[model samples]
Target: MSLVGIHGVSLRYGDRQVISRVSLQIETGEFFVIIGPNGAGKTTLLKALSGLHPLIEGDIQIRQRPIGDYTKKELARTLALVPQQVNADFPFTVAETVLMGRYPHLGLLAVEGKRDLELAEQAMEFTEVIHLAGRRLGQLSGGERQRVIIARAICQQSEILLLDEPTAFLDPAHQLRIMDLMERLRLREKITIVMVSHDLNLASTYADRLLLLKDGTVENIGTPREVLTREQLTKSYGCTLLVDENPLLGTPRVSLVSEKVAATISKDSGEL
Candidate 1:
């Protein structure tokens, strides 16, 4: 069965329709990436999948059951969402923050047991944040905080992970590290992951499949080669794009074609 299924889903905020009748299915144990230009409802779609926003139309199912049927705590046990940014003014320690992920599993008025502590520590180690366990969350850098948040999600022990712009503020090295970590976890645990990113190259590199959104609808959905074609991308993004193979990974590489350069090439070719 598909891990997630969305059918004719639409969402709106007041008079603004952010998502149109979009539908897609995500298979279990696959790495999926969602990509699009700004205001294409990439984040909104992620939010809808996470059940943070109620759908105005259609239905979403996880594991053959309706998503809305799961209670918040029940849902937390099945999926976790890592947002683009997280901020906190309180002086919570890194360990404390990570321990919160276990809330969904804890009994009423219960405290962290030996297994829970071990799980939290293991998650911290996986994300390389164990050394900073004593540090205050408010004092960490953006990259550090991002890792901490992911560690917390790992501690949640969900089968599916949803991430939005996970590499936004991180440097290149850290970005690779985060992706590598996620890939490793997914492989080892048979977890399913869906990420929303603007980095086409990164998406092409790691995603098993890509979903391209345009104006709140699916423009394309397929392997990188099929979805990242120049014709499809140009129509979806409303701009001329150059598509080529990435020399290292043999996946589709996308480049923006400047109008000035195109015009010059056109004139030179015409004069020949």
Candidate 2:
């Protein structure tokens, strides 16, 4: 059975329907990525999978059990979410913040055990944030804070991890670092990763399969080569795009074609 089963799922914010009927299966240890333009409900879908949003139409299952059947603590122990943005204003130290991931497993008194501290330390070390363990969360840079958030999720020790735009606003090096770390974690810990991202090339490179969402509907779902076609992207994004193979990875590489460049190419081709 699939690790996650999303069948005919739909959600809304008040009267506005943000997610139309969508269905997909994520297998165990798969790196599945959801990508789409803004307002396409990528993050909302992730929220639905994480059980943060109520489904208006269908059901989500984890490990063949209905998601709604699980209590909050049970769900927390089953899945971990790292949101796109975090409130770094908290004065808590980095270690304290990461240790919070163990709350679901703590006793009724909500006290951290030695095992929780060890897991927090291991998570920080894995994410390379051990150096900043004593520093305040607000004192770190964007990249550092993001890594810290990821560390917290790691410390949670959940089987499935959900991330929303984890690489947004990060530098290229930092972006690569985060992606690599996620890949490593997935391979080493056998974790199932479900991530929402806007970077087409990054998704193509890392994802085992990609789901393209457009205006609250599923535009396409397949491997990178099948979903990242010029026609599909141009239609979904309402802009001209150039699709080519990446020489290094042999995967699809997408490039935006501005009107000016499109016109220039059209003119040059006409003259030939």
Candidate 3:
């Protein structure tokens, strides 16, 4: 059975439909990515999977059980979500923040035990945030804070990890670092990853399969090669795009064609 089943799911904010009958199955240990232009409901869909957003249409299932069936604590123990923007205004230490992931497993008013500390330590070590354990979250860089957030999610010890634009504002090095860490966790811990991203090349490189949404609808869903075609992207993004091969990873590489470049090519081809 698939780890997650999103069947005919549709969601809305009041009367405006934001996710339209989107159906997809995510398998165990798969690195699945959702990509689209802005306002395409990528983040909304991710929230639906995490049971944060209620569906106006169909249902979502985790392990063949309806998402709504799980209690709040049960859902927290089953799925961990790392949103795009984290509130790090508080003066919580990195270690303290990471240890919060274990709250779902603790009894009422219970303190963290040795096992909780060990898990948190392992999570921090795996994400390479152990060195910053003593530092406050508000004192860390964007990259460092991002890693700490991911470490907290890892510390949750959930079977599924959902991320929303985890690399949105990081530098290239940090972006790659986060993606590589996610890949390592997928392979080593067998954690299922469901991420929403705007970076097509990064999605193609790491995702076992990609789901492309356009105007709150599923435009395409398949392997990167099948979904990242020039025609589909041009249609969905409403702009010219160049699709080519990534020499290093042999995955599809997508490049945006600016208006001037596109016009130049059109003029050379006698289409202008």
Candidate 4:
């Protein structure tokens, strides 16, 4: 059975319908990426899969069980999420924050045991945040804080990891670092990873499969080559885009056509 199954799922926030009649399957151990323009319902779809929002229609299943049937603790044990942004006002140390991931596994009124400590330490090491173990969360840089958040999720030890624009608001270098770390986790831990991103090239490079959304509906779903085509992207994104193969990696590369080129094309087509 697929690790995640969505059948005609829909979601709404008051009068605004965010997701509409979407269905898909995420196989075990696959690196699946969701990409779309702003307000495309990418984040909304992810939240539905994480069981954060009650669906207005259709059904979502995790491990063949209805998502609504899983209790909070049961869901936490099977899945972990790294959100796009976090605000830490409490001055907890990095290690302390990571250790919190073990809460799901602890008994009622129980403290973390030796196993929890070891797992937290290992997660810190794996996320390259061990050196910041003592630093206060509020004092860290954007990149450092992001890594610490991921370490906490790692310590959760879930088989499914969901990330929402994990590289948002970071420099180019930090973005690559986080994406690389995610790839490593997927390969070494053999976990299923689902990420939402706006960067087409990044998604094309790292994802085993791509899901494209537009206006609360699925526009395309397939390999990078299939979904990242010019026609599909242009239609979904509502812009003229130039799609070609990346010279270095041979993956789909997307670029915007300059106004001059666009005008030339329009003139040649007699649309001027």
Q: List, residue by residue over 185-252, the lDDT tens digit for candidate 1.
A: 88999989999999888898899999999888899999988888888887888877778888988999
Lowest lDDT 10-mer window, candidate 3? 263-272
lDDT score for residue 197 of model 3:
95
Summarize candidate 3's per-residue lDDT along 76-191 as a digit string, tens digits: 99999999988989999999999999988899985999999999999999989999999999999988999999999998899999999999999999999999999999999999
User: In terms of lDDT, which candidate is stronger, 3 or 4?
Assistant: 3
lDDT of 4 by residue, 40-100 (tens): 8999899888889889999999888998899888898899999999878988999999998
Where does candidate 3 stray beyond 4 Å? 270-272
Candidate 3: the clashing residue pairs are: none
Estimated TM-score for each candidate:
0.95, 0.97, 0.97, 0.96
Indicate whether candidate 2 or candidate 4 has the larger lDDT: 2
The runs of at least 3 residues in candidate 2 whose Cα sits more than 4 Å from the true structure, single-residue gaps closed, are 267-272
lDDT of candidates 1 onward, in order: 0.91, 0.93, 0.93, 0.92
For residues 103-201, what per-residue lDDT tens digits would candidate 2 score against the true structure?
889879779988899999999999999999999999999999999999999998999999999999899999999999999999999999999998998
Looking at model 2, the pairs that clash are: none
Instruction: Quote the positional error of residue 259 for candidate 1 in Å.
Output: 3.7
Clashes of each: 0, 0, 0, 0
What is the alpha-carbon lDDT of model 1 when measured against the actual structure?
A: 0.91
Q: Which run of 10 residues does model 1 get worst, by summed lDDT? A: 263-272
